[model samples]
Target: MTADENWWNGSVTYQIYPRSFQDDTGNGYGDLKGIIRRLDHVAGLGVDAIWVSPFFTSPMADMGYDVADHRGVDPSFGTMADFEALVTRAHALGLKVIIDQVLSHSSDTHPFFLESRSSRQNSKADWYVWADAKPEGSPPNNWQSIFGGPAWTWDVRRRQYYYHQFLKEQPDLNFHNPEVQDWALDTLRFWLDKGVDGFRLDAVNHYVHDAGLRDNPPDFRDKTEPDYKTYEMQYPVHSKNQPENLAFMERVRALTDSYPARTLIGEIGESHYPVERLQEYTAPGRLHQAYHTALMHKPYGAAFFCKQIEAMFRDAYAGCPNWAFSSHDVPRHVSRWSDHAVTQDDFAKMTAALLLSLRGSICLYQGEELGLGQSALSYDQLVDPEGKTFWPDNPGRDGCRTPMPWEAQAPNAGFSSAADTWLPVLPPEAARAVDTQGDAESVLTFYKQMIGLRQDQPALRAGDLVFLDMSEPVLGFVRGGEILCLFNLGLTEAVIDTANVGDTLLSRFADVQDEQITLGGNGFLIARRLSE
Candidate 1:
């Protein structure tokens, strides 16, 4: 494939949560100007692209995920000129820019939603997923928000209930309307015309609903749960992951194809059948890549890894998978899987190696290379609506969204000049700050070497994956029949046959003895095969 067609394949894309990455405005929040100043740091990591989270005009209800304007930047994140500068600087550093597109829903404050909800026969009455209440007037159906409670919220003006998959403030758009689809496509086209390399399409599966307003069936797997109180109590067959979504995917691909070399990555938000959904989205002529949380959970093992990988790659044309161990929404992998490792750093390094070695593209979250753990916050310090609403049971996403630490000795760890930040910069993250760990065999250094190594070896990059016969702790695989990759996720040292293992290209906490390879806790090895 030509560079234009295959440049995104197996590439490393760094994810930047713009709000917490760096603060240049001294307003206690990072903005596009900060990112412009930090472009060199991202390019230095040997990554191909940067996936910036939303910085659009918003009410901050669900952070920038609740976008009030699709085509404008929020003043807090700086003006359109700042965003243009950011894209220019990133491109100048050889880094492609991928901005987030929250097309599934819009902030209730958005003009579109405002006009739609004003009256029954407005110009855009069906612009949003608004429906009449049931005869009893409780809700339209038993559909529940992913966060919690009923997905439908009553609007007094329209005298109809609007569907919200997240916060009540984020109302779902009615993609069933062709005009809505055209509007969404225009949003994508605007950014593309402005030279954005790609988009991280948020909640891609939630674009359309069943339209029949059918109640979702109960999730009988866990019997004790009450219906409509939680998202997990029922299977979301009607609410999301609908069959019509595939048609929209093709439309998105059609638009993306119009702009050569621009890629579309869909975030499959459904709980059930995510892998299958990912496969469908990534099939020929669909998204360039699609990813779900198949590996981001708390579980740690070869068994889990094998299951997710096998299922994801079962179809030859399932398309490319974009793997990530941690993100702004999930707990830091190092912290989530810390108990299984002999040391925190070891686990972090292992995950870095594992993620880059997978047979698809990679998304490295900001601060992942620094071995940052999830920050623990007091209830009073919580800013996330989900964290505040769910409290002890589910702490929500605030911990992972904390500011990135740059200098250990600088005020606020050089994250901001303000007296305090939107989220406090904790000691653990500060200790592993970029300035503190200066090339002394650290996780940051390891990530650089590993990424470089992947670039040096073609098999490690665009090669097909073939899993080996291994059990439990030892997850072994070969790339393009030349690279032998082995990872021991458990504390117990496990041995794997090393007959075809040639030169030890890169290894950590591993021992090689003739025909046997012993991997220590969170150990890994990447090697090339002997000349045939």
Candidate 2:
């Protein structure tokens, strides 16, 4: 609120996946005007900032992740004026605005890629990652795409194969070229000059790849769990997470540091050493914060979380962490971990408290406050190529990318007035619409309470965490040597002796009495020590 240099520390960031947030144009898709109209809802949540996912000009391959124009907004998402209006309104409500910056790759349809692939002798010929085919006409290497199939796609125009970590429609940029780095930095400068607050760097680790064409090593881990693509079979040692990524990050940081209060939070996807990569990428002279997918992909439980968090902080990275349980790429946390939760609503509230109590910046995906479970979509309803590719085996991300339900009884659940939405809204999500639970004791209200508590308690926000020795199903930790946080991440109720505990600060389905506390299934509590 004070515009401090470290304003992001312990801040609550709300992510709005533009396509599903709101549809103001009656065109069955969300736009910037719709986001401006909904800014009040985000501000009401007591969030410190809002991180809007990619709304840039794209071919819609991999959704907006395949950017066609770095500085232009997609016609489907409104014009630049509309974006500026949204930023103005958000700042008026004392909320910082962060937009997604996808620098790792661009749509193959982009002019740069088009020019690069023209004849291999053009000015932009080296702008993209192109390589000669093997003697047998196979790909340059054995790299695989994250969506599926080979990472390399043969181009007849240039008579060469280009590398793409995702879909073939997306061509990886050759960051080894200095001009490309400068071009990307200029794109960030364009947004910063527009008075934007910060950027969430998409797939930051994928910005650079092994300079030498090399095959990745196989991951010999158990394959009992369902993996959507063969990409997971390999460790991606040569395909991405290259050592040169740190130098590029330093360049990005240098540009961002030129602006006051402008921050950079990088998204580190599934890497061999995500935690270590995050730490290195966010260290001094690099990214201000790095978001790792470890927590998002981890098994749900106290032990798993404790181990992950301990490992992350043990190394002590200079840059802070930006944590989130749900985002556009993954399934909703409530539904993902439903096997361990007694009820979806209870689990949602419990997770909200747990996330805010953690020692780092937090991100809340839109519709999460309403306890929206993943929408069950049929094969035909799926738009995500990844979802269609893995059908029954993986289900892809379409389930979590559905529209947000505003009015339960309204047409299309108030997301749009059109006959159909991009993705179907399930009955469960409609039943938990915003209007239906505004005045009730719902997950939305619980989020507001938890967020307010975090804003008021410094210990809960930027405190040092010390795990407490508690029995199974009861995970306890002390923050800043004062705030004691406890959770029962199981189906059965659990009780813990609270001899050192003091006055209750915030709680959900939990009570303390006679130096003891009883937590219901999927319950949580935050207490402050009297001695402190």
Candidate 3:
């Protein structure tokens, strides 16, 4: 692979949710300056890139995902100067900086939305997705928002119901409008010129909507499950994942390609046709990568992993698929996959090893390396509005957004000097703090070793992945070249035939050569071919 292709092919990216990373100003919220202060810490993890969540000016309805300004930094996240400094610092450490770009919609406070809603004939009126209500005075259609209500919000000013795939305060942009397309593309240029390496495009699949204003069909599945029948649960067939979205993705791709060593990775949310859409969205000259959370919500087991990986390769992502086990929105992998049989730390460490051995690029959520289990947040202490709205039944993401534990003994776990942090700092997490795990044999050390191993073995990073035929509870795959990985998800030790195996390179437990190797429950092994 050329240097440019090498940039993303097998690279490990560290995702930093700025609000929970660190708070330098003591305002109880993390800022860019805090990120700059911790650049050395991130670089120490040996990751190739850093993906920061949005810090743009927003109404905070959905945090920074609902942007009001495309070019300016939010006061809560520090100034634009602070952002530039962060880019400079990260680049100096040989780390690529990828910022979150929410192109699907903007805060209602955005100037485009303000002017577009002012008059139906205004120059910017068509820049947003707007449509007249139904003859019966209902919404344009039955589109539902992800935040638990109708996707269409009635705007009396324009005498129409505009589309909002998320919170009503976040109005969807009209990518169908050519000028609007130009504006969003220009926003990419603005950042690349400012030294950003790439973008994590937020809700990229929802860029285009059904032009005919079609009503969504009802889903017959149970509506009481946590993520089942919420507002976003209604039929999203016409509201999102439209085929027309590809042309605009191509336009965005062309813009990113104009820059050297830059990339675009989209966030696609769809259960049906997700992998298919991934293939189309990234089919060569469109997006460099795209990710869906299908596997994140499933139970951790050999069968689940097999199906997800196979589908990805068999479908659209057969050519290129970035692998991520966890991110900001979903439950942390450790807690989500914890079997009462194993200690939380064991699950966490094993998960890190498993994610690193995947075929495509890897994204590591913050604090995952420390074997950090999810924090338990009480209803009153939750900060995420989503968690608040669905309380008890569907507790939001605040459990995963707790402050990063930096010290096992320090007050507030060394995350903040304030008497109380924005999110609760759990005592269990504090015990596994970075300071405590900096020791040579700590779980954090294991991550460093595994990540370094991936970096040293070019074959592990970008080579083709071939799944090995195995029995239940055993998942196996040979990364192109010489590396073969075997994972045992069973509760009892099982011996595997490695008659063709050569030398052991790394193992979570026991080691073996050409002989039969016994894998402990939840254990894994990695070996290189003899010729290598």
TM-score of each: 0.97, 0.98, 0.95
Per-residue lDDT of candidate 2, residues 1-532 (tens digit): 5479889987889999999999999989988999998889999999999999999999898889999999999999999999989988999999999999999899999999989998979899999999999999999998999889999999999999999998999999999999999999999999999988899998888889998988899986777876657898898888878888888888888899899988889988865677788888888898888785777864877888888788778755445888899989888998889898788888898888888888878999999999888899999999999888988977889899999999999988999998988888888899999998777578899899999999989898888889988878888898988999999998888988877777788887787887888999988889877782
Cα lDDT tens digits for candidate 3, 1-532: 2247449777888999998888888877888999999888889889999999999998788878889999999998899999999999998898999999998899999998999999998889898888888799998777877777778888989899888888888999988888888898999999999999899998889899888878888754564545643554566778887778998898888888888888787888777666787777878778888765666784777778888888777833545566787788888888877762266766666677788998888899899888877788889888677787777876888888888888778777877777767787888888889999877778899898899889988888888788888887788888885788888776677788766676677786655645677887777888876552
Of 1 and 3, which scores higher on lDDT? 1
Residue 92, model 1: lDDT of 81
lDDT of 1 by residue, 218-255 (tens): 87575554543488888988998877888998999999
In model 3, the clashing pairs are: 387-396
Q: Output the better candidate (2/3) by TM-score.
A: 2
Best by TM-score: 2
TM-score of 2: 0.98
Candidate 1 C-alpha error for residue 10, in Å: 0.6
Query: Total clashes, candidate 3?
Result: 1
Clashes, model 2: 0
RMSD of each: 1.7, 1.3, 2.2
How accurate locally, in lDDT, is each candidate?
Answer: 0.89, 0.88, 0.82
